[model samples]
Target: MIHITLPDGSRKPFEDQPTGLAVAKSISEGLARECVAMEVDGQLVDLNRTIENDAAVRLITTRDPEALEIMRHSAAHVMAQAVMHVYPDAKLTIGPVVEDGFYYDIDMQPLSEEAFPEIEAEMKRIVKAKIPVERHEVSKANALEFYKNEPYKTEMISELADGTISFYKQGDFTDLCRGPHVPHTGFVRAFKLMRVSGAYWRADQSKAQLQRIYGTAFFDKKQLKAHLEFIEEAKKRNHRKIGTAMDLFSFHDDAPGMAFFHPKGMAVWNALLDFWREAHREAGYVETKTPIILKRALWEKSGHWENYRENMYTTEVDDEAYAIKPMNCPGGMLLFGTRPHSYRELPLRVAEIGLVHRHEMSGVLNGLFRVRSFHQDDAHLYMMADQIQSEILDLLRLEEKMYSQFGLDFHLELSTRPEKSIGTDEQWEVATEGLRAALDAYGRDYLINEGDGAFYGPKIDLHIKDALGRTWQCGTIQLDMSLPERFDLTYVGKDNEKHRPIMLHRTVFGSIERFLGVLIEHFAGKFPLWLAPVQAVLLPINDDLIPFAEKVASTMIQAGLRVEVDDRTESLNRKVREAQLAKTPLILTCGGKEKEAGTVSVRTLDGSVHYGIPMQQFMQQVTAHVAERRLELDLFEK
Candidate 1:
């Protein structure tokens, strides 16, 4: 008999070699029906795989996060089969699931729109066939022979060590994979063929370009529909579109990956900088700035000249080589070395809103997220060993304050030292303990991710949750002993001897440009009063009321408020509509009645109209909204 431990901490003895499906059926029919895959003794396996020894079991279904991944993997296989049916000669490469969908790379030429219908039709046929996907284990030699004609697959097999490989088969189609896929091909109900493009086999420019078909899928029809609708909505809110609509920013071909912030965009930029400066000052952080170009020897000493030379842009000054700064740390290190310090002046926190540049692949160049030039909210702390815990605690506290203000909920993950780390065991022990105690002091829950740290140190990452429920890694705190040792950064101890200082590198908003894009998407282009480029717009009902509207705009602007005037010959309703479309928070209209009564008609983004409020009263309401950065600002001004 074999004892199987279930997820609920209960054990059941099976008299013979029973499959995971058999165990599930014994427990509950509902669970058995939903169960798609299982794990035995920490190894994920197919439900049909027989379990003969004592082990731990976990059944994964559509309800599990990992199940979505498995289902999408099977969906990719169905898509591959569909493609093969349409173009019998098309050679398959890789079809893997990502984020919310799957993409398949095939070695085909010049695929166009005319191909989608035939491929989709073939997909329907495969779905109707309800083909059972059988998984088989094959030796490495067998796999290479089976895919001898398929160069990509053959290359993959050649790279594999001497071991058994898993292959999935549906109908006459089979592909090499390691998977615990869904039950059958018929399970792909909600699927969509999004787009097609060309991609290099391994993203290497020298490699042959392959045809890539991108698609998305969901478990149910409604969810898929909603997903498509959500995508459409996101397109509407895309910064590329909204930036032009609001006259915020633009991108030029000459400076492909650089953004040109217009006047309105400058207002938003200043707003962020103002808030950042205020927070850093209150958090005991001293701000510093560094030059954009530095000597090549500096980068060489930082180890980036060797490892990151490909990404760093080089130039020459007076026949000597210099490199454009790709990072701010080396400059910060130079500053730390400029002055000798003592233990009494320890825990020195230096911050920089430094601009950096790098050569990113053209394929991966996104709006503001993956730009060639951007600013980092970077900080580096030089402290004694005893101050490590308190420094991390301070950084976390500041991170919480900044993120909460942006309506971002964050989770912490403590990444342990990697296999090839630079620190001694004693140093790692002290640093790890410091981080653990800091986490405990805040009473926050965090999971240990083994071997995910940087090459030089251990760290903690804060994943910020967006409105779409997606987590973006935006904050990090890394402890480094190697850099200090390399730079010979020292502080005098109480015994008058020099001791190496521990360096803690941290960033709250990892990239200012990316954070700005996130803010745009999170707020859905309807920025709060404080962050809005034009917080208020003054609208006059007619030509006669133009003077009063301008007066009100001027007054608001003088009071440190961002306000604009729309005194065009357009109708009152048209002006209001334009302001609403621009996503401005508040609009004050000056009609004859409002002008005569020393009042204004206030309107909001939500289309609420409030009539006859004194200008002072309306300003009070606006100030309150701006002060709180309210999610739902009151339209009423009385």
Candidate 2:
């Protein structure tokens, strides 16, 4: 008899080896029907795999969060099977699950969007067949012989150490994989092939180019429909299209992944900077600027040279190598070592908005979200060991204050040390516990993400949710003990002896350009009054009133408002339509009636009109609204 421990601390005795599906059936038939996979000793595996020894097990049903990944994995296999059915000569390389979806790369002829329909139809046919997926483990020698005809598969197997290899077979199709997929093809009820693109085999340009098919799967049909709707809405809010239509920014082939900001875009950028400066000033931080390029020796000492060499851009100067800074912490370390410090100044908070550059693949470069050159809002805090919790709490408060200004809601996550990390075990434990205690004291719930922290230390990551219910990883606070020791930084203690100070690296905006991109989509290009590039535009009722419109614009501009005057030979309706398309927050119209009365007709972006308001009163209201940085528009209310 074998004993099994369940999640609820219950035990069951089974005769000989039992599969997870059998365990589920012992509890209830409904559970057996819903079971998609299982976890044994905290490792996910196929439901049909037999349990060999006494262990703890938890059956994963379709309703569980883990089921999505299992289902998506199975969907990829079904997709590969479907492709083979259509084109027997196609060679498979890899199929992996990614964020929100899965994809498979195949060495085949170039495919177009027109081929998606047939491929999708074949996938649906396979799913409806309810074919069982069987896992087979074989010796490396057998695997090598089995895949002799597939060069990509043979190459992958040759690189692996000599051991048993796993493959999954469904119907007449088989592929190399180590997976815990869904029980059968029926679990993949709803899936769609999103797109087809070209990719080099291992991301090396010198390797064979292959066709990559992208897709997404869901357990429920309703969920799939809702996801498709969200994709459509996302297309309408694409920042690149809106940015070009508004003439805010542009990108040229000369600098493929770099953004060139126009005057209007600079207006929004400066406004964000002003608020950042005010918040940091009140939080007791001193700003600093560092060189954009540093000697290679400095990076070698900081450990980035050995670990991050591929992503860095290097140049030779004076017979020595120099690298463009990919991060700001190394330079900040040099600044901290510039002078000796006493414990009284132990909690030295330094901040910088430094521009950094990295080498990114041209294929993965996005508008502003994935750029090669961008600015980082970085801060380094040095403090005593006892001050860790308090400093963390302070940083959390600052993060809240800044995010709330933009009406953003965020969730916290505590990431533990990764596999290949520096520092001793005791140091990691202390740092991880320090962050945990801070979150507890702050009275907020956070998720524990195991093995995802920086190599130097454990950290707290902030994932902010935008208006469309999409989350972005924007803020982080990392505790580092490695850098201080590497740089040999020390401060005088109260007892007149030198001591090492704990270091904390943090950022509210991971990338300024990425945050701007999120903001554009969050607002659908309808920015708030304070953040709007052009706050207001004055439209003349006719060519005769052009002078009056210009006069009002001049007054508003002098009062620190970004204003424009429309004096084109166009009708009033056309001008109003153009202004609305530009997403102007306020549109002011001047004509004979308004000019004679010294009043103006104001129109808002939402098409709400307030008639004949005194020009001076209007200016006061507009200025107050912008100064307050209100999230919503509530102007001229009773």
Candidate 3:
């Protein structure tokens, strides 16, 4: 008899080797009908797979998070099958599930978004057929022979180890995959073909370019519809659109990945920098400026020449090769080496808002988010080994405070050393442990991502979620031991001997440009009072009130507010609408009644208004709001 242990610690004894379906049926017919897949011994597998030995099993239903991944995987296969049905000449490469959807790269006739409707219809038909998905294990030789006609599949087979490979078949369509797919195509009840794009095979530019079809799936139609609505909302909050609408920033073809900040955009940028500087000062950090270009020898010593050369841009200066700085750490290293340090100066925090450039593929160039040139709010802390935990905790606290100021919610991820990292095993272990201890002390949950750290050290990454529920990686705290060794940085200890200092490389805002992009979407271009380019705009009802509007604007300007007066010939409604479109935090209207009463009517961005407010009272309330940096406008009484 084999004992199958369920997740709830219940066990069932089977007389013989039984499948997951049999076990489920023993529990209840309803459970058996609902289970899409099973986890046996913590490994996901088809329900038809027999469990011969005693093991733990968990049934995955539509409600389980993993179930969505399984269903989406099956949906991808169904999509491929439909594509093959419609275009028999199409050659499939690979289809894999991403964050919220799946994509299949194929070599076929040029496909466009216009073709999604027909492709989706075909997929729907296949789903209606409820084709059973069968899994088969075959020898590598047989797998090669089965896919001999498909070059991509054959290439994949040749690269695999000499062992058994898995393949899944659905009706007439079969593909090479190690899948724990849904039981049948019918399980993919709600799906949509999102769009078509171009992708190079294996993501190598020199390789064959293929058409990639992107699609999403859900367990039910309601979830699918909700996701579609979320996508539409995201489009409306897209930073590129909002930036153009607000006249914040723009990009040009001549300077591919650089942003040209307009006057209004600079106001927001300067405010953020001022806030950063004040916070850094309070946190015991001294700001520094470094050159934009440095000698190649510096990069080589820092390991960038060996590990990050592909992303770096180099220039020949006076016959010597110099690199346009892709990262600020190397420059920080050189700065530290410039002055001999003593242990008394331990935990020396040096900050730099330095510009950096990296070569990004043209196809991947996004607005400010994926720019080739950007500024990093970087800081390097040189501390004694014993001070590691405390320094890291301080950095974490600063990160939380900064994000909180922006009203952004963030999660932490601890990334360990990567395969290509430069450090002794013992050094990496100590560095990683220091970060882990700090996180534990903070009493917050964090995810561990193995083999995903910087080339020189382990790091804790902060991923912040915007209003629309999109996550962006912004802050990072990297603990490094290699840079000091590479640069021969040392401080005189109490023993009268020189000892290496441990370096903490960190950035609260990973890239200023990217953070701005995130902020644009997070606030939907409706900035808070303090951050708004124009805190308030005075709109006169007619030309008669223009002088009163100007007087109010001058008063506001004297009170250190960024205020503007709309004295143009436009009608009262037109000027008010324009101010709303501009997303000004406050709109104050002055007309005959308000002018005679020495009062102003306050209108907020959300269309709430308060009439006949005394000028001094209104100024006091707005000044207090801006001083407090309140994210929401609660100053006006409605």
**lDDT by residue for model 2 over 14-99, one digit each (tens)?**
99899999999999999998999999999999999999999999999999999998899889899999998898899999999988
RMSD of each: 2.3, 1.8, 1.6
- The weakest ten consecutive residues by lDDT in model 3 span 629-638
496: Cα error in model 1, Å: 2.5
Best by TM-score: 3
Cα deviation of 382, candidate 2, in Å:
1.7
Model 2 stretches astray by more than 4 angstroms: 10-13
TM-score of 3: 0.97
- Candidates by TM-score, descending order: 3, 2, 1
Model with the higher TM-score, candidate 1 or 2 = 2
Candidate 2: count the clashes: 0
Please give, for residues 134-170, the per-residue lDDT of candidate 3 as tens digits.
Answer: 9999999999999989999999999999999999999
lDDT of 2: 0.93
